[model samples]
Each structure stands twice: as structure tokens, then as C-alpha cells.
Target: MAYSLDDLLNPQVSKVTRSTDNLIITTYGARGQGKTPVATKMEKPFYFAFGKSGLSGINNVDFQPVNSWSDFKSLVKLFSNKKNYEQLHEKYHTLVLDEMEILYKYCEQYVASTEGVRKIKEGNGGYGLWGDLKDEWENEIMKIIGSGFCVMFILHACADDTGKIMPVGDLKRMLPIILNHSDIIGYVRGNGSDPETGKPIHSSLMLSDTDEYFARTRNEYFVPYIEDYTAENLVNAYYDALDRQEKAEGTSTVTKEEGDKMYEKQRITFDELMGKVAECIEKMCNAKRDEEVVDIVEKTLGKGGKVSQCTAKQYEAVEVILNDLEEALA
Candidate 1:
């Protein structure tokens, strides 16, 4: 079924559009659920876990297991900020959020505590909190999606009285947002061993959406370099996925030199890039200026290369060395 543009534009009329290429994989089960296994398979990824431990077991990844909701909020804000993450994002690929149930709790508490909402809640003596928090929750979600980063939201599957599966945070009306916004939604369930009798076990990954569009393999976009549960794998997968997108658009990955130039455009300085320049200078001097035997080679000189004479990168190296000198003296 289709409708005219004007008809579709009305707020009352509903439409679904996937504007972001992000994938939100929700992993759930009991406390020991292997939700982490799925994220570990990705390349160049980082984990911000609110629960679960053994982060050291995973390699090629950065892990931030938060002990409190405040830590989670602050980290999320930092990661999404363009100033902090831009350089890091250039070097990495995936961002995974383990135990999204924690963030779910934070969102509820956050919205309920906001000055505007708190006033309403206080006036109502706590009766209006649920209504007040809906917009705040949506705003938090918008920030996450618009962050332009690959995110994985992990949750636990809870069994209701009816023995039906529900996401851990489903009680707070989070399931719908988790469902509608997620590029992929799934669960992990395992067999419970009967204490009395020995029996075979069965486990499966449950898909949330019945739509045919989601049935296609997500691997088509991002192919793993190898079989491993490492952040490097997530990173590799992210690159491959993005490369596939570029290939479809008739483009290719840029060389390191080109990528450096692109990064320099944003005022980012690479230590390795500076090291490469020093190596190149040494190579050229060895071939031509070896006879001169200069006592020291300086990339930048305040005496000759004044404040305005150097490029931003040259200034960076000079500033770093100067900072070292100041620290040494102190």
C-alpha cells in the first residue's frame, strides 16, 4: 500500500525509513548468557559494559565496564562528542554497549530527575514520572543514533509469568524503541539441564522481526577477517562493511597517505606520521648531506621557524617536545 506525499507527511500517518546504517544487536538470556560472544566476533570494537566481567579475556578491544550509571552517562557523552571521538573514530571501527539494561535504568532515572520533569513529578507526588520521561528517553536515543558510530546494545531476556520472553528493560516501555530503531534484534536462549535426568541441550538465536527485509545476512555489509572475539575483528568488520557500501557507490578505500591528509584537515596530529617524516629526513640526509654531519636535526626551530613559518603539524611536534622540557624542569 502507498499514499501521496502530502498524505504521508502528516504526523498521524505512519511510515518507516531506515536513515542510519547502524546495527543494534540485542543479546539476551540468563546471567551467564553469551551475549558478549556475538560482539567479540566483530573487528576494531570497544566495549562499555554495565554488567558481566572477564573483560581481559577479550583481545583487540577497549573495555570500559562501568560501576555506576553516572559513569555510563559521562562515557556515552564523551564518546559521542565530535571533539573527543573524531580522532579515535578515524582509527577504530565498532562501539559496543554491553548490558543496555543499565542505560535503560539511567534514562528512566535521568528523565525523572530533570528539573522540568522533577517539578512535574514532585507536583504530582511521583505520579507523572512515566509520562514525563518519554521525551527524555527518545532524546537520549536520538543522540546515540546521530552519533555516527556503530553500536551494539546488549540486554538480558526475562521470562514473564506466562513464560514468554521479554527484554530485560521491557517493563519501562523500552522494548518498542529497541525494536523499531534496531537494525538487527535477536536473543540467545540455552537449554536448562534437568537435575534429575541427563538430556541433550538445544540453544538458538531468536530473531525479533518477522519482516523479510531483516532476514538477509548482516554479514553482507561487514565480513569478518577471521574467526575471533576481538575488537580488531569488529574493526575489520566495520571497514569491510563500509568498504562494501563504498564499492556499491563506485569508490574505494583511501591509502594511508591520503587518510593522513584527510585527518590533517581536521587538525589531528598522528605521532606515527611525525615519526615517518623524521625517518624520511634521515634517509634524505644520509644520501646527500652525510658529509655535513650536523650535530642535531631539528624538525622545528624557534630561531629560524617562527610562530607563523611552520605548518600546524610542525607546531604540534615542537609543542610536544617543549612540553616535555617544561615537565623535566619541574
Candidate 2:
């Protein structure tokens, strides 16, 4: 059925809210400079060590030893599985891709082997192949993100010919893609000594396109510079910033009647919301395995519960989950 102009212009169409809980943090530093230490401090971190740099010094952290690009891809698939995601949600809060520079090299090698080419260049059509590989990597990353895990990438910093510290890879093509998806980029530095203790002081500088390095934070509360960098410290800083922003927005003083009126103005009806939910579920089921789809429904709406029986709040939750799923599939 076609809608009239009034229905089409209805303001109560239901808007989506963004979650600030998940973070994408990228850190770079020289070897033995406490890059792994920062990651080790995160809540229940699972490390993917690609540089053969085993978590020798780090204790009691779960890690997967990745040898090749194929291994990493398989690992991504494993994590994307619905059953594993449920288990992982209970066991881990963060996923760390250690030494992303090595991962990039492996991606290059994988492209070369698959395309029967020796180098990635535009002339030999390897550039297009590299783009495809990058897309694959991005899809896996987004899936992990959508699964509600904090994604962290550790890299070894490289100095360009101009002595500017940058992520070690195809900066022109690949770095922008990585940066665009990242919420924070930090450059590690540890040269100064503590004034009182006479011990070395290590710090990570969150950048903003400086002449010396590339760093930034989407969170305004971040000082754009940190004298000390620890996983707990950064996470706390983020939430504190979020809290400040929330407070700055001020609390609503509307009464129940006023609030109800406002909500009525913005809220989509139960039937309208269910229609969108059904369409989203159909798309999700088509993109995922049947068991995964069933698991998601059960988790969100209870065992054997149909979408039609969901309450308005439950429908909102399902909508968010389905949106994440569709984005991951995309």
C-alpha cells in the first residue's frame, strides 16, 4: 500500500542511536617499548601475534599465534561465528591485532600468491588486487567491532625520508583507510627519564596530523597528548569524556505528560517498527547461517519467541543488532 504525503512526512520514524562503549585504538612504537604492555592491560584481551613476537613478557593473556594471511582469515571466520561470539563475549572484551605492519606484508604476499604476481603495482593490476585484500581485512575488522569487542592494533613505527614517524606500510593508500576507521591513533615515545625517580618514562602521544607524526582522537575530552599511556588510563579518559559531554547536554526537566508527548512525536508505532524489524531479520538470515540467525533471535527475544511478540523496547534492541549484522555483511 502506498502512503499519503502526511504519512510520508511523519516525524515519528524512529532514529538510531550510536553507542560510545566500543573503541578502535591504534598504537605504534619501537620494539621493547611497552606497546604490548599497554594491550596487556585491557580487559580480557585476546592477542593475534603476527610478527612472531610471542607474548613472552606478557603473562596470563590469551593469544593466537598467526603465521600467515590465511591463518588470520580463518581466525576472523572463527570469531565471526555466532556461537563463538557468544562465548567470546563472556570471556574477552578486547581483540588485539599485534604488529599490523607484519599483517600488511602478509596481505601483500597473499595477494601475490593468489594472483601469480611478484609485486603489487598498478601496471600489473596488482593494485586492484591489493584493494580487494584490504576490503577483506576491513570486513573482518568491522565484524569484530560489530560483535562488541574493542579492537586494538599495534604497529612498529617507521620514519619516512623526511624523518616523520608514520605507520609502516603504503601510507598513501592503506593508512588513510585504517585511519578513517580508527577512533584513536597514538604514537609511542619513551626517551625522557622521570624527574624524581631517575627511571625512564614512557608515553604515547595521541596525534592530530603534526609535522612529526600522525595521531588523533575522536573524543574531545582527550587532551590530544598523554604524558603516560596505559590501557586503563585511556579507557577511563574516554568514558570520562563521554560523561562530560553527556552532562553538558543537560538533563531533561519535562514531566511525564510532556515526555510522553515528545516521545509520541518521535516514536514509530509498534506495527511500523515490526515491519522494519522483519525486513532486517530477513536480510540478516540471508547473510548469515541459519543457526546463527536462530541464535541471535533467541538471544535477543528469548527462546522460541517470535518477532511479532516482542515488546517495543525489545524491538529496539533487535533493530540495533540487525543493523550491526547488516553492516558487517556489507
Candidate 3:
């Protein structure tokens, strides 16, 4: 079967009528800012702690301590499998990955071990290597995403020399791709002991992006800031955002000029290009037939052009194919 321009223009992806319990969330904060405790509050969470010490005081959490990158890869393989994921989902509805920075190190270690390179730089054929790392990381993460389980990724926040708080080092290189997958990105602020009482003050989660750090929720309905942060509140805000979306769907319409203006307002950076390529690869990976993969390639880059060779100029075409495939799948 072939799709025509009419089909492409009006996709068959069903209207999203209800809220989903599962979400992809990322939260970062300074050490001892209660990032882990906040995650532990998520529904039936199963933790995969990359660091050694964080979980000592945290209780009632079922976790697998990851000793090496290989262990983490094994877990990914296990959970990404459909039957295995089904069984795991019965017991755990959420998966929490702690220490995002450490996980990046593990990814680098895995890449180094497999590629026999100590340094990752464009000079050292790092573009392909970095792409490989990104592909592997994104591929595994998407599988987990498609698994229909809530995911909470925890990262440590660091202040740059000029005092901008954000993810640093290798993890910084991958933040854009990770953020593309997240529905919510929050920065936790754990209030330290009060001067007079030596007890904790009110801490909060920042959901709006700031000049100082990376943070944002998907919609206006999501609480811009969460005070006395708990996983429940975050989840509720997610539902509210969904409810608003559901209510607003088809209630109003966008004129072509307005749609064009809205589209023009979107900033598609190079990192987003990388993200689209990742999505293309993900589609190829899950493609039911070799012909479907070939169709994607032909539709995006013309015959015999590899997706790995896609440039920024090819972004819109790539997105069109991806959207078509998504609608077809849906």
C-alpha cells in the first residue's frame, strides 16, 4: 500500500483522548537535595543506582546496584524485551535511573572498551563514536519508553564558573537528546537546615526554565513550580496538563497562517537534528518489515542515501517520514 499527499496531510494518528499514567521525567539538583527521595516517592519504582552510596539511607525501594556499564546494558536488554517487560511491569510501574553523570561515564567506558579508544573527540573519529553512543543510549531508552512505564532519571546539578547551574561534562553533550525524550525536566531545591532550628526549610521543584538552569514542563497546566515537592504532585500536574490538552483538542482550530507562524516559532537546532535521526533509527529498529525501513530511507533521503548521512537540510523531510510512520503505526 502506498500513501498519497492527502494521507500525508491528514494523518490517521488517533486523537489522544485520555491521560497516560506513564511519563518520562528528569530531575536534577545539587547533592543532598533529596533527588533520590523524590524519585522513591514515584509509583512502585524500581531503582537502578549507578553510584555506590546514595541509597544507603533511602528505604523501601527495590533496586539493582549497577557495578559496570555491562550490568546496565544487560538490564536494558532484559527490560526492552516485550515478554520480560510485561512481567516486570506487573511488579514495577516505574524505573528510576540515579546518577545521570555516572551513567554517562559508564556509556563512555562501554564505548571505549568496544571501540578501543581512550578519547572521544571529533579529531579521534568521535563524531561517529559519539553518534554510536547516542544511538545506543537513545535506542535503549526509547525501547523503555515504548514499554509504557513511568521513568524517572536523576542527575546531579553543578554550577559553572559563572554560576549557571546545569549538567556538566559528557552528560552535557547528551542533555538535548535526553530532554527531547522527557515530558518534564525539573530542578530540585532542597532547603538546608534553618539557622535557628537546625531543621530543614521548605524545598521545591522548579519546572520552568531559567537563565541559570535547565527546567521545564510540557504544558502551561503543569505547575510551573512545585513547593514541598512530592512525586504525587508532579504526577497530578502531569494529569492536569493532559486533561487540559484533552479538553482543548478540536475545541478551537488553527488557521494556516497561524499554523505557519507557530511552526516558524519552533527552533530546530543541530541537536534536534540528531534527535530526529535517532527517531529515524528507532523506527528502523522497530520496523516490521525491511520494506518499511527502505520506505523510510527513500522517503527521507531518496534512494540509497543513508540516514547516517542526513544533514540539517534534510530535517523537514525526515520529520515528515517519521510523522507518517507514527500515524501509520498508531
Candidate 4:
């Protein structure tokens, strides 16, 4: 996992690799399909509120209210420190309110040359506090990511012409955290047919598991799967490389002693190293769980059992295989 200067020069990761500092997830949809609901479901374990009011109709969620941006920043710091948010999620995760488009807008404003960065201030459409929003957003995202828990960024998308790409939308002027960060790009679509005909009309999850899939569908590696004439079989494809690394290397062991060993070898910040160790403790610590899956796979294959394809999307077979591979990695 050696990182060369050249690799850093360009702001991209290797073919199928993922780093801890950049675990980003974004979900989009037209209407219904519970895109937010599913996202909220995932964050139900740890939902922090910024305003003083109740979540009102928000279900399957745990709410912690914050007062200001500074408080939010402080929360991010504590989580990264691994001191706070330790109990929120056994693994440490945070939910930022409407973070996606904000970061996108932040990026756009940053590129426009903000007021604070330019100083002097031009309130009349001139650079202002928002001008420096991008730099601040980018720095904060890294902070949250560094802090243990996984982050969930909610976003809104619309069609924008005059650019490259379709189902296109401006990152709301929020662009900083997005320009160089965000590991996963997800879109939410709903089944569009007849209710009597068993058509789904809620938000569906269309995920980008690999660059190849992205290129094939949108002719652009990052374009979301929201265009017309698409299928209801939108599958959530994510990079499995992270889990695979642990499985591929038999060297992975789980005792505290082994944790320390892996920590030193990983050489990321100590906290990040420890976080992985914690997750490992939950999985590898139990020998039965680790061995059970491989045992099942072997027995199934021995019986001539073939993997089935039930992925809603077209090429779902590919999705099924990748899922199997991810299981192996796990």
C-alpha cells in the first residue's frame, strides 16, 4: 500500500482500492422510494440534529441536537479522537444534515474566489464568508472521515445543461468536500410502472461499484444512474477492496497483540489503525463466523450448487459474483 508522490499528485485512488479518510456515500432520487428513508434507516443508529426542534415524523432514528457549526466541527473532532461518539455506533459513524449539495456549493464558491480568501469583501455578489466555504468544507470532511464513524451525506440533484454529463445538476454551489473527496457516488430511483402491474415508484439505490460500470452506463465514470429508459433493477454496487484486503492476507489475526501488529504495519494514524482493529475484533475474534462462510461456499460448490442471479439490475449476475467476492474479502 505504498503511496508514491505521483499518486498524490493526482487526486484519485488506485483501480479498486479505498482509503479510510475518504469513505463517502451520497444518495439521489426523483421522488418517493424512501431514498432518505433508507439512508435514515442506515443512520437510525446515529442521527444528530442541528436545530432544537424534534425530528417530527422521523423514525428509526436517534437524534442528538447541536447548536452551531462550531459545535458540529467540535463533534467531528471528538469522533476522530475516538473519545466521543464511541457509544453512538459500536463502530463510530456520524450523520451530517444535508451535507452533499452544501459541499458541492462550497466547492463552486471556492473556485469563484471568495470574499474571505480575497479579503476586502464585496457584499454585492463579491467574495464573502461563502467564498471560503469550499476550503472549510473539504477540511471538515477529512476531519469527520478521520474521526472513526462512517459519514452519511444527503444530497439533492436536478438536470443541468451546458455542462458535460446528464441527469446533470449543479452541486448547489456546494462543491468543496465533493471535488476531491467522497468515495461512493449513489443515486436513488423508484420503480416506474403500474401499481397494479407491480411497478415500484419509490427511490431506488443505484450504486457505482466499479469504474467500468460507471463508464458503461453514463459514458462518464461518475454520472449517476438516473437517466430515462433505465431499469428498476438498480443495484447498490460499492468497492469491496477494503474488506478483500483483510481476507486476502492470511496474516490478518485478531488478538490485541495481533491488532498492534496490524496497526504498526498499516502505518496510518494510530486511531485509524485501532478502528480497523475494533471492527476486526467483532468479526475475526469469533473463529466460527470466519470459518462458517468459507465452509458453506465449499460445501455448496462441492454439491454443484451454482450461484444465482437475483440482482434487480441488468447484469445482475456480475453483481452477485462481486457480492460473493466481497464475502470472501470479509
TM-score against truth, every candidate = 0.50, 0.66, 0.68, 0.48
Residue by residue across 308-328, what tens digits does model 2's lDDT show? 666766757656555544544
> What TM value does model 2 have?
0.66
Model 4, runs deviating above 4 Å: 1-22, 50-56, 91-96, 99-131, 162-173, 197-202, 208-330
RMSD of each: 17.7, 12.2, 11.8, 20.6
Q: Which scores greater on lDDT, model 3 or model 4?
A: 3
RMSD of 2: 12.2
The per-residue C-alpha lDDT of model 4 at residue 215 equals 13
Report the lDDT tens digits of candidate 3 across residue range 169-230. Answer: 45545576667788888988887789998987656899998888778876666767888788
User: Candidates sorted by lDDT, descending order?
Assistant: 3, 2, 1, 4
lDDT of 4 at 135: 54
TM-score of 1: 0.50
Which of the two, 2 or 4, has more lDDT?
Answer: 2
User: CA lDDT of each candidate?
Assistant: 0.54, 0.69, 0.72, 0.45
Error of 3 at 178 (Å): 1.0
The C-alpha stretches of model 3 lying farther than 4 A from their native spots are 1-6, 17-21, 121-128, 160-162, 169-172, 194-197, 246-330
